[model samples]
Target: MRRWASVVAALALALPGPAAAQDPIAVPSPILTIDQDRLFEETRLGQHSTREIDAAAEALTDENRRIEEDLRAEEISLTERRGSMSAEEFAGLADAFDAKVQAIRAEQDAKARALASRQEEARQAFFVEVAEILSEIVREEGAVVILDRRDVFLSADRIDITDQAIARINAAGRQTPAAPAPATPAPDPVPDPVPPPADQ
Candidate 1:
């Protein structure tokens, strides 16, 4: 009987305690959903890039107009000179005109490449800012995992923090003033007109 009682006590001690009465494998629902687009649009860096891109586009337009005008003027001059020139001279002028056109095209191509590179760089910087904000949100919400709204099939409105994220991102971005635009050098001062010599 003593041996039986000792065996029973040992068995009871080995069994799970009261703390183990509850389920150990409870699955948690996601706490929040994020809309990456909204976050990107609302970010401070995004706004800055938008403004910069607009300015770049406007400048490009002006550059294009200048190029077009130069081409048109060259064409007009070539036409007028062709009427007075020998065939050889006209051919040389045509070749020169072609060279000028090619040069202008190359310049335009360079400008386009530069613009694309700058835009890409700006986008990368904007995304980095978004990533930092998302990290902060994750910590604050105690979320085990955050899903992009685009990826989820369905999520309750309560679980969506996209609007809140945008607000935070915008607020953080607005705290710092945008960097000043680089100054364009002023055009060289017009030379003073010399007085015509008195007629003899």
Candidate 2:
């Protein structure tokens, strides 16, 4: 195994780098990019949704705090009464308190999950409406495809249409039509893909 390892190492060092093996493809001209995250964070619709979500989260926090205070008070009261009550009666009350705490925790957890789902729904709705604006920009630019900026390794700033999309979305105001479900694309196989060389 040691002899084979040395031979493999020698062969790897003799191989040429990727650049020497193949020429790099020039950036495609008809491809445009947009910052999907920026589209969600900067648009008026996004801001509106964010404000509502934040308010709801704060309210949830307040409710949790109040519940905790109430529970703590009940616990102290129960402790004080433990001395006066019969042992069996005190045990029953303590068991009920524990069950109530567990039930409250489960209810609060469900509420938190519902809040998260609401946030996701808002994001999906924003994208559905913004897709129309993006399509218009693509048509105007005569671009073949709109890629998420994060997916592209290198591209000219001129190809980015995020700002344009945001402006159009905000300008559309409250009169914008109701959003439909997002279109899902069919998957296709890549042709002759070259795997990157592994490190020695």
Candidate 3:
């Protein structure tokens, strides 16, 4: 009976238990990777920011087109009257028109730079808002570091957290509010060139 009991015990020890029978548990990597570009581009906050910037750019384009048309018409009118005026008077008007164009161009250039700055601000804000979620992921994964995927030469696909991050951002309903559109001053209408005094 003792021999029989010993045999049974040995058999039990040799046989795989329920835990061993199951698939091995995957160990989380201490180092993780994320695609920062995808994290920004695919996230709700990023999308919202992009839309706002694009709308502003489109509006600026429309304004530029209208201003160009107005300037073109003014130029034609000025040219038509050139034949009636002395060269000196025409030169003065021409110089003034050129100066006005330069001023408008400078103003528009500044606006374009502001738009670029706004875009950068939006990107910075996005990262700031998501910092908490990223921290949580790092803790959950037991990761010591999260490297940008672009910086790594080669890495396993499983380690990338960009898609996961995007999903979390969506789930959290994170969205950037539309920034107030910059006030666009109407392009000053080119004043009608004053007619020259009648020759003596």
Candidate 4:
């Protein structure tokens, strides 16, 4: 074994460097590249999440449109009545309407923000599960480094693991749990009232 090792070592050294050998004894970088965007687009969980987000956005838009139309009609009606009302009464009504519109806008904005937060949380939870799948694949492949395809200009097709990851993720489970809701902290228990000292 030692003699064979020596012969092999001599042969490798004799074969000029990369410039000459071309690849008589080349060692690959063992870097894995993945198309993350493709993975997300193709994965079942990702697709479902996207659909949910789109539906939520559409619902909000429709609700907003309805509110806007109602407000518009009210504005037109108020304009028609302006001439008949006392100035103070008209001013009060206008102020109230403005406040109501502002409140509606604020409420819609909050709902939109909440939906966005939920979608983001759901995705965050998904990636956590995906990371495990990726780690397992990486180890199996003997990869020293894993890279997102977006950062790479080019890579051998053999190094692409996006499809494998998607498969493994799907096989692991079809039911991707939604991100857990934020916990509401329990109110502090009221301190028991000290027993009233016996009247002396």
Candidate 5:
């Protein structure tokens, strides 16, 4: 009877009785990659950003030109009449022109800074939406990691999500706020025109 029981146990072992059904090991998926440069150039948000930058530059150029033209006219007038004017009067005119030039420079710089700030704000909003979409993609593809395409040396184009990212960006339609008007700071105090040397 004991021999019979031993034989039965041996048969059970050989028959594949559930001996520690090990939990299926979880394996990490392959890393996914994105062509960020392409996304930036081709995406709707990117194109919008480019347009905003271009518009800002054009506006700045127009303002600079207007200021320059005015200054040029004043300079020409000063140059043409310098011979007849008193030394004091000419010096005063020159000083005024210099002050105008400085003011224009400050204004233009402020405008540029405001435009840049708006652009950055838009870019940050775009990336936030991008991250949300990427989370979905990660689950869909079972990707363990996401890396910039620039960093990756070799990868199947199948892993490239640039087009999809661009599409989602367009769909998101994240609105960029218009640039804020630059605050008018108090003008710098004009220095007193230096008195011409007594001998001159």
Candidate 6:
């Protein structure tokens, strides 16, 4: 019985055993460094961000100019009114004008806050897309590890995959169109004119 058991074991071992595991079943995973700054600079997100900022700046400038003109006009009107009015009347008018000025400033502040929030949200989305691209590259290359090029002090050009990564990222980005900006609401339409009263 022991000899029969030995023969069975030998047969099992001789049955070709998964072709001997060709190359030790170990994947060669090398660290990949990417120049993220360069990638970002060349990306669509970067271009979009730059344009958004520039437009915002121009809008702010125009707002400022409008406010300045309004203030100047108010000041000139107040000067003329003050010269002709009694002290009590002048004081009341000045208070009303001051309130209007404060309201304008508040509106400006709210607009600024909204702009900042939108910009932050867009920036976060941009980074998330970049990270996804990096992950995809790591998987495709069979890389077990990846390091940011900025963090490393020395790396051979072969290990640097920034150009390849950027190409892939751009290709991926081109696949999806960016969401369209929200449309401005239309102004309310004027009501139809009421019929004139009949002659009394």
Cα-based TM-score, every candidate: 0.61, 0.67, 0.74, 0.68, 0.66, 0.56
- Candidate 3 lDDT over 1-200, as tens digits, reads 99988987887786557777575437777888998888888887888988888899899999989989989998998899889878988988898888888877887887887788888778888899999999898899888889998898656666778888889888999777755545676666655556456578
Best-to-worst ranking by TM-score: 3, 4, 2, 5, 1, 6
lDDT of 5: 0.70
Once superposed on the true structure, which residue ranges of model 6 sit more than 4 Å away at CA? 1-39, 140-164, 173-200
lDDT of 3: 0.82
The better candidate by lDDT, 5 or 6, is 5
Worst 10 residues of 3 by lDDT: 189-198
RMSD of each candidate relative to the true structure? 15.8, 19.4, 14.1, 15.1, 15.7, 16.3
Off by over 4 Å in 1: 1-37, 140-160, 174-200
Which of 2 and 3 is ahead in TM-score? 3
Model 6 lDDT, residue 125, Cα: 60
Off by over 4 Å in 5: 1-29, 152-156, 171-200
Candidate closer to the true structure by TM-score (higher is better), 3 or 5: 3
Worst-scoring 10-residue span by lDDT in model 6: 187-196
Best by TM-score: 3
- Order of models, best lDDT first: 3, 2, 4, 5, 1, 6
lDDT score at residue 151, model 3, on the 0-100 scale: 91
For 6-100, candidate 4 gives per-residue lDDT tens digits of: 98787777545656645443454489998877776688877777777777789999999998998899889888988986776677778777877
What tens-digit string does per-residue lDDT give for candidate 5 at 116-191?
Answer: 7776665666666578777887888778778998897555455677778778777877655434444566656555
